[model samples]
Target: MDDLIVKVVVRLAGVYENHGERVYLDAGHRALLGIARAVQDEAERRAGVGGNKVEGPVIKFPLDRAWREKKDRDDA
Candidate 1:
């Protein structure tokens, strides 16, 4: 992607996720997919060698559709 295009994508993604989504404005699925790809690329670049590899048991992102279905679900 072009440098300016990447910058625009990142900025738009940020605004949509942070503010636009909260206001009931729909961020189309295709844009979301693009954002994901862009972010992953940025991460891999910043992480350097083996950055894309996940070797730990840690969960970076939840796979469940409704991890918050129950409020106060966690134990203290």
Candidate 2:
């Protein structure tokens, strides 16, 4: 839909305006990133793809696994 495209463009423009040319590399732009995610979900829904559907292989990892592993190594 035209509106979805417009929303994407507007959100992208906001990212560029706030973070210069390479917006994707800016990890600290949480508000802009959230807006971009919402726009993506909206566009996906409009295209008949469920907004929550995963498009790729899922990788599961424990959040504190790396920290615990490092601590074990240090203790050893």
Candidate 3:
């Protein structure tokens, strides 16, 4: 396993041993929340806000192609 993953597992085990199951679960929950928040923040940074734009690669989703094709069909 990766070093970071190993460290997190060790830390969580220590938490469970010292605090109990509730604290360990809370720690894991909080870590997941942090990861989700970071992803949202990064997405907003890349997508920009208001009329202001940022210099970054555009992220295209699979649904984007379907939408474009639908729009083209409608226009034709």
The best candidate by TM-score is 3
Off by over 4 Å in 1: 1-27, 50-76
Candidate number of the best lDDT: 3
lDDT of 3 by residue, 34-53 (tens): 67866776777778744424
- Provide the global lDDT of candidate 3 against the true structure: 0.78
Residue 64 of model 2, lDDT score? 96
TM-score of 1: 0.29
lDDT by residue (tens digit), candidate 1, 36-72: 9667866887778444565554435545656655533
Q: Please give the RMSD of candidate 2 to the true structure.
A: 9.7
Report the C-alpha lDDT of model 2 over 1-76, residue by residue, as the tens digit: 9998787678767877888776634633754666687688779878989647665655334469889999999999
Score every model by TM-score.
0.29, 0.34, 0.59
Once model 3 is optimally superposed onto the true structure by TM-score, how far is the C-alpha of residue 7 displaced, in angstroms? Answer: 1.4
For model 3, the run of ten residues with the poorest summed lDDT: 52-61
